[model samples]
Target: MPSIDLQETGLRALNTTLQSVEQKDAAYTITNPMGAHAIACGLTHEINVTIEGHAGFYCAGMNQRANVTVKGHAGVGLAENMMSGTVRVTGNASQSAGATAHGGLLIIEGDASSRCGISMKGIDIVVGGSVGHMSGFMAQAGNLVICGDAGEALGDSIYEAVIYVQGTVESLGADCEEKPMDEEHIKSLTGLLALSGINAKAEAFKRYGSARTLYNFQPDNAGDY
Candidate 1:
């Protein structure tokens, strides 16, 4: 295990060392992050990184095969465009928490602001607390599980991605509607919750997805466009 104090090492050096192939499988402890931006971005190795304090914008962006844990809150774009592995935030996250991420899991133990999983491709996001409006807007694929209440226009203009909310939803977005919770969905939610380590029950959640009505242009539905 190695420890780096961001106050002394600077953000550039910290990211450089974490991205090194020579440090494969190493465990690193970063102290006094003090809300620094891009704390551990672009890591391509199977290593463990622990950020001991709050992190600023784009923390762990473009991450691949690395487990990054933030002991405190995370700022905007947390784990944006990540490919694999895991990114866990023990506290709340700002807007666009997992924007455009292609794969892997993102676990936010606390609340998340607006656009939580916007345009997500294949990532699985599990939010232990509430999320703001338009959480899954334009999501092309993957699953988003919200353990708490959702704000207005949840899953706005969504695509193939699925959303599971355990609490009340203020509203549903255009082309997004609540769907039946069949056995397949129950099984999937069970696995996702288990992976996230959240104690919420799968049966308590309601599923939402695209109605496929906006896939093409139609004069009758033109107003929705």
Candidate 2:
């Protein structure tokens, strides 16, 4: 594994190397991130990057086929708009973690702040700790697995996304409601937990999703609109 110190090589040179390289399975270790923003954005190759310390905003934005791990905390919008690849944060994450992501998995070993998966298209996020209010707002399609409690207005106006919470939810959003977890859902949750290396029981989770009542415009329910 090639190791680069961000303090010496700079973030621009690191990202440039990741983007320009055509190697199949390159591995890199980044040290002294010191909460640097946009550390590894727009990578398209199947590589592995390990950040030894805290990272600032958009640590691995728009990543594809790369597996990036942050050993410490992450700033806002971590893994934002990612297309594919895995970004794992060993520590807490700020607001809007995995926002509008289209594919792949994002794992936060610690808590996540507000709007955890806002407008997420097809990403899968596994949070080991609690999430702040308005999580999964306008989510299109994806799975958000929260091992801990959820704050107010969870899944506000969400669409087609599945949210699984092991702890209590303060409140549900406009079109969100608790749903039954069938065998398939249980199996899926189990798989996700295993993949994320979370040691929680799948049966302990409660699923929340759209009520489908707001799929079409209803004049009688215009107050919510």
Candidate 3:
């Protein structure tokens, strides 16, 4: 394991060192992040990285194979456009967490701000706490598991993606509606919860997804578009 202090090595140099490492299952510990932007973006190796403190915007964006753990809160766009592997935040996250991610598992142990998992593509996000408004907006695929409450306009214009909320929902977005959970949903949710290490019952959640009404354009529903 190697430790890099952001206050000493600088951001670019730290990223360069992490990116350049080709060893499999290599581990790194980053100290004194101090809310720096893009702390460990674009890491393709199957390494493990631990951030000692808070991370700023776009932390761990475009990550592939590498596993990133944030010990503190994360700023906006956490794990944006990630390809694969895991990104875990032990504390709260700002808006648009896991936005436009392709494939990966994002675990937020605390609350997430507005637009969490917005425009997500094939990413599986598990939020241990609540999420703000407009979450899962225009999500194309994957699953968003919210262990706590959800704000207004949840899953607006959602496509194919599934949302599971264990707590209260303020409102549903356009084309989004509550759906019955079947055995398949239960199985998936069980796996996700177990993988995220969240002690929540799958049966306690309510499933929500696209009603498929807005898949095509309709003149009578122009306001929704």
- Listed per model in order, the count of residue pairs whose N, CA or C atoms clash below 3 Å is 0, 0, 0
TM-score quality measure for candidate 1: 0.97
lDDT of 1 at 202: 97
Error of 2 at 191 (Å): 0.7
| Poorly placed runs, candidate 3 (over 4 Å) | 222-225
Superposed by TM-score, candidate 3 places the C-alpha of residue 126 at a distance from the truth, in angstroms, of 0.2
C-alpha lDDT values of all predictions: 0.96, 0.95, 0.97
Query: Can you write out model 1's per-residue Cα lDDT over 1-225, one digit (the tens) per residue?
Result: 789999999999999989985566789999999999999999999999999999999999999999999999999999999999999999999999999999999999999999999999999999999999989999999999999999999999999999999999999999999999999999999999999999988999999999998888899966866
lDDT of 3 by residue, 1-225 (tens): 899999999999999999998899999999999999999999999999999999999999999999999999999999999999999999999999999999999999999999999999999999999999999999999999999999999999999999999999999999999999999999999999999999999999999999999898899978866
TM-scores of all models? Answer: 0.97, 0.97, 0.98
The worst-scoring run of ten residues by lDDT in candidate 1 lies at 17-26
